[model samples]
Target: MQPVVHIGAGAPGARIRWGPSPRAFGSGLALFALLAVGCSEPVPPTVTEPKPPGLESEPRWLTFKCVKPGCDETLDVTIRQVGARKLAIKRVVLSEPDRTEYSIESELSAPAIVNEQFKVSVRYRPIGGPVKGDVKLLVTYTDASPEEGEGRIPPGEVSVPLLRRLVGEPVLVASPARLVFGAVSPGESRSLPLTVSNAGSGNSSLVISAVDSDEPTIGAQALPALGLAPGSSTEVQMGYAPQAAAYSEARLLVRSAGDMVAPVEVLAVGTSLPDPTVAALPAEGLDFGRVEKGTQKRASIEVVNRGGAPLELESVRVVGNANLAATLPNEATSLTLAPLESVEVMVWLSSETSGDIDAYVELTTNDPSARLFSVPVVGMVTAPHAVAPGSIDFGKVPKGWVLTRPITVQNEGWGELEVKGLTLVLGSSDLFTLRSLPSLPLSLERHQKLGLEVEFRAEAMGPFQATLSVETNDPGGRFLEVPIRATGSTCAEGCPLENAVPSCVGNECSIASCESGWFDTDGEPENGCECSEIGNDPGSSCQEAHYLGEFPDDGTSQTFRGILPWKNDVDTVTFFAKDAFNWGADRYDVRISLASADPSIRLCVYWHETGNHLSECYLENENCPESRSFQRTGTGGGDDADYVVKIYREPGAAPTCKPYTLSVSNG
Candidate 1:
């Protein structure tokens, strides 16, 4: 017999029954008899389903739009758990070739439990040009709970790779970014050719919406509108037309549609022309009012074209009086004037007999209103004349000193001379005075004379000049001028310092500055600059280097000291190496050392005649010693070849007062 087990639905219990079977009837009947007699029914085994933890991302991929270079764009991504169990986010990072341009702005705590949803912000910033390729976002996480459902999910960390795509937009570029219309007339215009091209990466075409200008005088025009494919170009004309005489500037803005690049600005500049006009100095008229008989009086008129156009002078002449004469510039009969050009016309009057004269100067020009211009000239010839000393000089006088001189006024012509007044004119008039002048309107016959005195007082140091005017009735000598000059000095004996500039301080003579290559070492104004730095002389050169005595054969060092008197000043000295006592040794080592309190001082060694560089040394700190060693072939009894040593301040270093010492010895 065979036994079978059955589970009841109503209660948690199981029942067993036996079936007829030849193979297992013996054992089955024995097991059934024992279960039925010794044990109760076996309870049914309990069972339950397992739930695993999982993570779900809001965005599977990231996309960024870069409007222009150096523009930043930002986006956010959400992460949450979809399964029943929670997950911990370990870390988030960006990985790519151009990963530097992308950044993760959101801060995430390591091993954080994600029960709800969390957001991660990402930003993209392009530096220059077009950005290419994509970046990957790597999110690393691990299971926060233990294994479930008989180890369905392994206990370890996991990483999810997310992709980001970068798209480049269209950019506009212009050749010859600036336009210059040098000079344009008021009614004319100038244009410069410009080529516009698309410099972006992608299949998008650059479409220009409008071209605008900031100034009315400047404009831009494109041929057949503006639409260029990638790596394609179009021609444009930049124009400038000014309405007046002035400098103008404008910015031409090239606007595009849906372009990542900003509007391109092309600067346009130009200048306009000015109108043509004529002008003249002494515009009223020419007046040779009065003059002495047998004397000639001259006058001049300046004509100028003060505009942008040319001016034509058909003729310039004197037409009225027989005594009047006219002379043109360069003795030309006709003249042409360029813009802002000028010329002078000379006119004179001469007559043997005494009488009144009247004349007019005729100027024929291309001026619309004034076709023929006339300038009136009037004068009278007289017989009386006056003469006096032309000038008086007081020479150099000490300050606070006074000096006086005599002036004589005489009548030399045929008629009687009438004296009106005497006056001092122009520069430093307060320093000069007229003394013992005769009464007004005094009369004197021909060959008669009048005596007068002029005094000058020196108040300050410098040159002083003035004019003495003697008024009279003479035709040519109505106002006779005599120039007077004097110079005032601080000291009566003047400055006597050698190689020094003189100055006055507290009413005492002093030294202001010393001549080149000279210094005031003693601080004494009496002796001037007594110390002369011969090493800094302009005539000193490498050929004239100073000679330093040969090194001692007893192996003792020889020391020499000097100061760099000026910046970039080089002091060269040469010395001979003494022969060594060793009979077979033909060469010996010589050590050159330098010490200075200034770090800018440097020393160099060279062959005297050949100028070949041997060695050089520079100090890193003050008072620190630097040295160089070089081999020199020695003779038995005589000195070896001379080696040149140069001590100078390093280039681009400020001049210092510190001194340096150079020592040479045999090693």
Candidate 2:
């Protein structure tokens, strides 16, 4: 049995945003003071109430200055009323005819003052210090009260400061805090749309600026020197041109005119895209030689990072709706791989079932070439009770017509696939001639298949069971056979020719033959027999077992281990190593061989939950002198998640109690 592994997949904590946005805080405060504010009382009115018991207040001011030069000026202003009944000001003269506008608003539920030149005093309710909103005022004089006048206080305008952090076209969200681009190509220039949002509740224009450290190679540019307001964001592609030098790595920085001192960084890395880029994994159509269904084959591919920087592979995944799984061993888990370094991940794309199906592997490394890499698969398993349909039903043909069918051979076993030569059995020696197609190359990929065409022709009428003898490089090939049927026909006038081989050349006939073998026949011996419930009989029952334990070491890292595929052995499996250092398991290769009581059947071992193939142990396929070579693999840095292993049986194969051995050493 293969090891079963499970991991945590979600974050463990949560919190809410309660911090006010800096841009929003500043802008909102200004808006609050401006719309509901009034100028100081006129003629220096004397204050009379120095002891209002229970009323507490503090002073704050609102300011709005366009930080541009040459527009420097003050404004004439006075309190139309001493106290707020709706605070109002008159004589609002513009410092520059172009700079002043009459704008004022009142606090919530506040009344309006109706005086002209700013009255001296009036009893007014002290608006709670928290008063806020935009106000309206009319220009009493086109000229702003001269800023040159001594002791002169210039009236200022107040409104929300439009955020100018970062953004294009849309000034609202001028900059982005995070930017992500996946799988970019060489010399590809992508315009990355960016936006800086005022995450606050106030109105602020967004301002954005881009700074490129790797100029030209990886740089930034923007329209509208200024930014945007809150809630608005612009879309722009980040233009990227990877130089031959950039064939390695690249970076871009964008700066915002905000509190952020360091600019946000954008990175570009090179990739080893497949020769022919594919959005998904493709089937290479391989030959698994010839094994059985319910078996597994193991293979590996390199995950090389061709760029200069480190690669963060969130996972090395297998993506088919099927439960087949693949993974990067712990050493490769969430690896931060340096440039040019490759990590080998284990892949299992075939199931323990049968069919001409496909398994997709989703390699989750952000390699610029191919972010998501897929290894194509072709071979699947054939039914346990059935052989590949390699026969041609070319019904009765005109004496010399030939029909053909191509059949694929697949090896889905955990062991070697043996393709013994084909034997031409005379299912119809007198009526038909059967010949194998030209010697065809038949090297199948693991779980992969190879197709062969068989031609059939008839010369006379007869019953046929084209016996196809499959000679295999596989040791147990003699036990398995393929059968092809080629029924032939010859018809003559009303001779009432029935089983003499008939095609639709004449009328159809419904005939039934009855034969009883319990009694002796006058001139025939029974070739086929049928029996009905002769006596009480029972069918075989199956059972499930679980194994979870530690691995044992025998030799150095060069040693091996063994266990049985049945009950007692199924509960425990162990492998040996050269040394005791857990980390050094990387130096050893672990091979586990499967042996069964039935030499005609094979045992299959794979990861239970993920269906990941670990190894294939043949029943009697391997016998050197007196033993078999156990398949080895390292559960390096093996732990609870990586150390356990499992073994099961292929369909049509009987369960055995023979012990399977595991060989360990470094490859």
Task: Tell me the RMSD of model 1 versus the true structure.
Answer: 39.6
What are the Cα lDDT values of the candidates?
Answer: 0.67, 0.40
- Candidate 2 global Cα RMSD: 26.5
For candidate 1, report its TM-score: 0.21
lDDT for each residue of candidate 2 in 1-667, tens digit (9 for 90 to 100): 2232221221111233455565676677667666656753333333556431111111111233322222232322333222222222333322332322222322311122333323211111211111122332322211123335543333322112111112222222334444433334565655566544434333334355555556455445554443444444454445555544434335656555565434556554433332222232113522334335556776665555555556767766655436256678754557666654556666664556545555556666565676776665445554322135454454443333355656655665433454646556654343334344436434443466555666666555554555555554443343345566665554332123122222324332212232321211111111111222212111121112222222334433332233222222233232222323454345334444544354533333322211222233212222222233344444544321122233333444433434333333333
Best by TM-score: 2
How good is model 2 by TM-score?
0.23
Clashes of each: 1, 92
List where candidate 1 sits over 4 angstroms from the true fold. Answer: 1-276, 287-290, 351-358, 376-380, 384-416, 419-667
Q: Cα RMSDs of all predictions?
A: 39.6, 26.5
TM-score of each: 0.21, 0.23
